[model samples]
Target: MLGATSHIAGRVLPAVGRVPGNVVEAVASRPGRVAAAGEVARRFGARVHDGYDALLGDPEVDAVYVALPNSEHVTWALRALEAGKHVLVEKPMALSEQDCLRIGRAAGDLVVMEAYMYRFHPQQRKVVQLLGRGEEGCGEAEGRGEGEGGGIGELRVVRAAFAYPTPVEGNIRFDPALGGGATWDVGCYAFDVPLWAFGVEPCRVWARFHGDPVDLGAVAVLDFGDGRSAVLDYSLEYGPRAHYELQGTRGSISVRNAWTTPHEDGVITVVTLDGVREEVVPAADAYELQVAAFADAVRGRRESLVVPLDHSVRVARVGEALIRANAVGDWVDLTSR
Candidate 1:
């Protein structure tokens, strides 16, 4: 693991320990943070390195799970790729879409993935099935639905929101230099649901930020055109909240506690003009499942990852465009308007 001091990394390391054939072989962090790194190393029974470069050079380490701050992601991921290691990076892959492109160019034929564990959850699988996708796998939107174009066809609008009470002092999320802000921190969750649900990218984007230099909240609009659009709204000042709703021509889906749903079995409700049906999803740890998939891919047991580099770049463009829009108070056209 690189940048092992993050709490999210904490969660993933333990999951890596629990998942079969996956292990936390080594950890790296800042030189001043040796105590924290040592604690994790002792708990995971893994070696520790003071510098990230040293960890990457370890021959025993085949793959690296990066849980670094938002700003360091791109640089470290590129470095890790150059060192000939598979990488599973935490979300927002890089501070800029261009950086994402750099990582992509550097990681040819190697497994490099952005870790958005939520997309790996069974709930998403349920959404796929309800939207008429085959139970085999994801994002394959064809066949329409039900009996010949019957299921939730013609996706109309998508709404996603993720907010928490507020940030405490010194939290990295509020650190501007670290590429911190409410939008990139939590609101990115909003984009994933809509983008991944319909498997489409917006043609134009607009957004507004709530504060200066640092954002306390953000509201963005992604215009997919053709009467299909998405609203992504989030705030650090709001009370605890998380939810997303997807509407279609025939039916709709509303997910409660959208992002943080427990790994255990969960329920998703599908509603239509006819009636509301509930589907049960078995217990699943998205992070753990993510680890297994990464391990499989590293072991050459799989072909592709769920959150590929292109998806990460798309997310980066949407977000950075939103930030730019917020700055200029103009609708930023992702397609060069």
Candidate 2:
């Protein structure tokens, strides 16, 4: 694992322990963070490296999990690929679409994936099935007889909000240079749902922000043509609210605890003309599932990554459009660009 981030201990390291064929060969961080690295290594019974490059050179390690600041993602990911190590980097693969493409080009026959751990959860699997995708990546919608989506019919709009109180002081999210902002931080997750649901990129995008240098909060709209759209709002200064609602002709589905899933039991509520019902998804650690998937892909057991590089590129493109729209104060035409 790379970087001594807190979540690595709380989420990823434990996941490494639980998933079969996965182990923490070593933990590495920047200089002066040896104590932080030591804490993680001691707990998991792994070696500690003083810096990232040292960890990469270790022959015992096969894959590297990058949990560094967002700005540092592309550089290290590229370097790890060069070092002949499989990479599973965190989301917003890069700050720009061009950089995402760079990672894709460098990763030839090597397993490189964006770590959107929540996508591997069964709750999301249920959502995908409800939207008529057959048990895997967000490919073309399948024939479910009743129009398109199995339970929700033809999708019209997706409304999502993911927010929590992240203080301004010393918070990396508020740092402009570190690729810190509400849009890239939490909005990427929100954007994925709409993109996955529509199974296409938006024709037009518009947005507004609440902070300077970096966005503290943002509200945006994506136009997918044919009156289909996605409304999204994300913040780092608001009360906790993590959920999304998908509205369609036949019925609507509301997902609570959508992003930070497998923490507690997930709740998916579907409402249609027939009636209203709730599907309670048992809590399962998404990090472990993600680790297993990465292992499978590395061993050639899985054909592709759950969150492919192209999907990460798309997410970066949409994110860029939203930020540009906010800057220009108008809707940006994606097709023309």
Candidate 3:
């Protein structure tokens, strides 16, 4: 893994231990962070290095997990790809569409996946199934006829929100240069669900950002045209909350604990003309499932990736436009950008 000091790097190490044959053999950090990195190394039983470039040259390393700051995701991912190693970079893999596209060019033949573990959760798949799509499918596969909303009709909107209490001092989410902010950090996932659900890129978007280099929170609207839209709001300074509500003809589906819903089982409440029903999904280890999918791609067993680089590029485009909207305080034209 790259950057042992990242919080996400620490969060997933235990999940890595749960997956068989996916050993984390080495971790690297800056020279000043060696002590902390070494602590992680000792706890995880992996070798430690202050120089990331040196870790790339380790013959024992089969693949790399990049949990570095958002800005460095593409850089290290490309380097790992050039070194002939598969890579699983964290979400918002690249800060902008241009950089995301660059990473696409460098990811020739080697397995490169963005680590958005939520996409692997069974509840997300269940949401698709409820919308008349194949249960076992990719992130953005098209859905069939809209199922009756029960009481609501025609699926017209998807509302998603992801927020957390204020970040502590020194947290990377507050740094603009490091790809910090509410939109890049949590809003990306907010956009991901709607894009994946609608199966088409938003044709127009407008947003506003507040705070420092990045944003403390953002409220945006993504119009997919033809009466379809996604309204999303995300913040870094709020009580902990993550949820999404899908509205369609006949009824609406409300998923409590949507984005952060773990694999230990979760609920999806469907309110339709028929009645309100809460379906219980089986327990899942989202991170483990993501790792398994990455491993399958590396082993040539999977045909398509869940969070393809193209998806990253499109999302980055939307995010950049959002920032632009904030700068100009007007609705920016996405196609023009």
TM-scores for the candidates: 0.93, 0.95, 0.93
Q: Which runs of model 3 end up more than 4 angstroms from their true locations?
A: 143-153, 261-264
lDDT of 3: 0.80
Cα error, candidate 2, residue 242 (Å): 1.7
lDDT of each: 0.79, 0.84, 0.80
- After superposing candidate 1, which stretches have Cα over 4 Å from the reference? 139-150, 261-264
What would the TM-score be for candidate 3 when compared with the true structure? 0.93
lDDT of 3 by residue, 1-337 (tens): 8978788886677778777777879999876788889999998899998889989999999889998888888889989989988889998888788988888788787778888888787887777777766656547746422554234556689899988887468888888788788888888888887877777777778887778666899888988877888999999998477888888866787778765535357688999777888988887777777887887788887554778777778888888888888788887777664
- The clash count of every prediction, one per candidate, is 2, 0, 19
Where is the poorest 10-residue window by lDDT in model 1? 141-150
lDDT per residue (tens digit) for residues 131-213 in model 2 = 76666743333332134444777888989998888878887788999999999988898888788777688899999999887
In model 1, pairs of residues that clash are: 263-284, 264-283
The local lDDT score (0 to 100) that residue 274 gets in candidate 1 is: 79
Tens-place lDDT per residue, model 1, 176-271, is 898888878787888877677656678888888887567989888888877878988898889576788888877877777655544456667778
Candidate achieving the largest lDDT: 2
Q: Between the candidate structures 2 and 3, which one is better when assessed by lDDT?
A: 2
